[model samples]
Target chain A: MGGEYLANLADSLVTVMDKMAGLTCEWSEKAPQLPAITEGVTVVSLLGFTGAEKGRVVMEMDIETAQKIGEALNQEELGPFDKMIFYALSELSNIFCGAAITQINNGPRRPGLRLTPPNILVGEGLEIFGERAHLETASVFWEGGLIYIHLSLEGGAAL
Target chain B: MIREHLQVFAKASSDVFASLGVQAVHQAPLAPPDSFFSRYDLAIIVGLARDLRGSVVYSMDTETALALAGQMMGGMSLPGLDEMVKSAVCELGNMCAGSSVCNLPGLTADITPPTLITGSKLAIMAGSDNVLMTEIATSFGTVEVRLGLEE
Candidate 1:
């Protein structure tokens, strides 16, 4: 995937989040994708890859921080990263992908972007995709809180 | 306050998506007061408040989302709302909010965490003393959201 395309995708993500989601997140295309640790893995949001390109965007956030947002977002009493918690996440990815499509569709250059729904992987262990793929990510932080955003775009040109 | 917010947001979401070749109607004749998909459906929504309070999102089940995504795909069955699908839908919610965030002045917004919920028995945490559960029946499925706000 071209850097411009990825930058478009990441910028699209920040734009949607800012204009749509009411979040004060900053997307830094300047950073590299965080490596999923093998020793102590955390909860991960694994979304599918599609488009005039192929690959996925994986998000890893500390559970404590998730609970902080969950506290504000959750309506019923329970813990963080619960089964239903994925709903909160699923919707995020859905809208993100939707915005991405909107950009690629409207962009001056035709990149042909396609996307699938996101899945929240609760299990641990280092999971990576596309060995020869180039990595680009945005370090999303809100109020000094940490939420890791990783975009894994692998080989291919179409969905 | 959150309940009213959802209704307002939902209305705005429907309105915006309508312009983008999306017709989001409430579940009435199409789904009904209580649809079969309700039992198997799960919705998770998150909001952002930066330039404005973002629209509250409701991410329901893939079984339900796939039906919608399939249409976005122009008629193609997928194994379910996987990585790309989920994020796309999340982005849909994001777009809807952007479409109308400015209407709610005094706060800018953005969305984060496209977390996925796959299983049943969703126990949401209601920290407030009083929580209102709004049974929002939509064309896709029944959207149950817990609203908590002071003032």
Candidate 2:
């Protein structure tokens, strides 16, 4: 995938976040750095795409950031690492990826992409990898916190 | 029927471990849902659809995850859970779920890609409340496999 496609996907994600979670997010020029373990709990949600295109979308942020967003969506204060928070995060990824796929399919060269349900991962220290893939990452600032969104496409083909 | 399906997962876990050059002994009867503790630090969840609609979760601690990753990488010493190690762990869960589904007679199912989660006091809430869990004793450590099928 090209940078333009990634930018479009990031834009779609931001729009979804704002609309669904009521959290405002802006794209950052800086890239995401490796998260330090001292930063507390981190949640990484992965949603894979198959069918016309093969790729995966990853959304990573700290637990505090997730809780804030989840609270906004749920309209209540959520406990730390609550199952409701995880479900909210997973649905956020799912909706974001689904919208991004629609944007991709609208392009001239449609990959006919279809998104899989979001898979939620929560941990203190984590590293994610995709085999035979090309990765495009975008850092976004939301509610005084930084979150990273990564789009990894398999086989290095342009979609 | 549920016991029969659970047995398929047990067999697949043993076979996958054996193929990775590790010995995993079955603990016989499956564990109850409440018996599953939240002490595990890492978990890999795979969703099942079609003939079987639910999911399978493989839970373990950091030690077990690293050990299993090392075994999968041919005894490579892992400093921590890096990208490579995480991928390996996810692939292991994917293989276990995929192979188990194949063993079921007259049953067809499609599995979602495996997802890995690591944290303290973590819990997996599957679609169904009725879960059948089994413990597998491996050379490195113990892995608890939970199966949740919708009625």
Candidate 3:
């Protein structure tokens, strides 16, 4: 993946947040330090892209943050973290990824990527590990809290 | 048809493990009651797109994971679920998913890179009403394959 591609993704995210949730999100210049053992549960949304270049995009956030942003997107007051919030998060991931991948395809080196439906995982002290090609991480700050976006390409070139 | 597709995936997983010299016996699909949420200590998730659109999640406990990783690393015993072990397990998931697409005959599909998730309590939502699940038994332990695909 190119730096240009990363820029497009970040821009897509910021734009999506503004349009969908009416929230302003900015990418953190410095990588935020996460404690070794986080106190609350984390909700992660995993999605995949395929076509010319295969890749994966993951969105990570605390459950509370997910709840807050999910509520914003739904334009309703949701009590605690529940199934409704999970559905909202899943839809949020789908919309954000669809927009970002669309931008990449329209731009140079368009991969013509297609997306797989997102899966949401909820757990305490969750950690994700795997081999990645050209993995890039961006931490975004919003009114709710900090969320992380991890984008990585896969295949021969990535090696 | 979805059940058949899931069966293809199960056979693909067993075949991949067999190639790695592990005897994995795949059981029949679990009867369902609409959507199901399952939890495990470790899970490898890969998204499928194109002809096959949805996700396949392979979940197991840490002990089963360590044993399988050890087998992948030339049958050496692993002390714990270290980075190498986790990477090996992730690769195994990737291989299983790739093989599944191949076993589906003429379907043109693609699999995303495997994502290994570890947590004290990991809960997975199939996200599909028509969920197909099966358990595969091996000397190492049991690995559950839960597939949720778009109709």
Q: What is the C-alpha lDDT of each candidate?
A: 0.48, 0.74, 0.80
Instruction: Order candidates by DockQ, high to low.
Output: 3, 2, 1
Query: Number of the top candidate by lDDT?
Result: 3
Task: Judging by TM-score against the true structure, name the best candidate.
Answer: 3
The residue-level lDDT of candidate 2 at B119 comes to 66
- What's the TM-score of chain B for every model shown? 0.62, 0.95, 0.92
lDDT per residue (tens digit) for residues A128-156 in model 1: 33233455666666673555666655543
**Candidate 3 clash pair list:** none
TM-score of each: 0.44, 0.74, 0.91
Model 2 segments beyond 4 Å from truth?
A2-5, A33-38, A105-112, A156-159, B1-7, B28-38, B44-56, B65-91, B104-133, B147-151
Q: List DockQ, one per candidate, in order.
A: 0.03, 0.25, 0.77
Q: Sort by lDDT, best first: what order?
A: 3, 2, 1
Best by DockQ: 3
Task: Say what the RMSD of model 3 is.
Answer: 2.4
Residues B1-151, model 3: lDDT tens digits: 7778888988989999999999998875564524334556899998899998898999998888888888888999988877788889999999999999988978988888888888876677654545678888887889989888877
Per-residue alpha-carbon lDDT of model 1 for B1-151, expressed as tens digits? Answer: 4544545555666665455444566432211112112233344433342332222335455565665555556646768646566655555544555554545445444433322344333233221223344443445554443322223
Q: What share of the true interface contacts does each candidate keep?
A: 0.00, 0.08, 0.80
Off by over 4 Å in 3: A33-39, A155-159, B32-37, B127-130
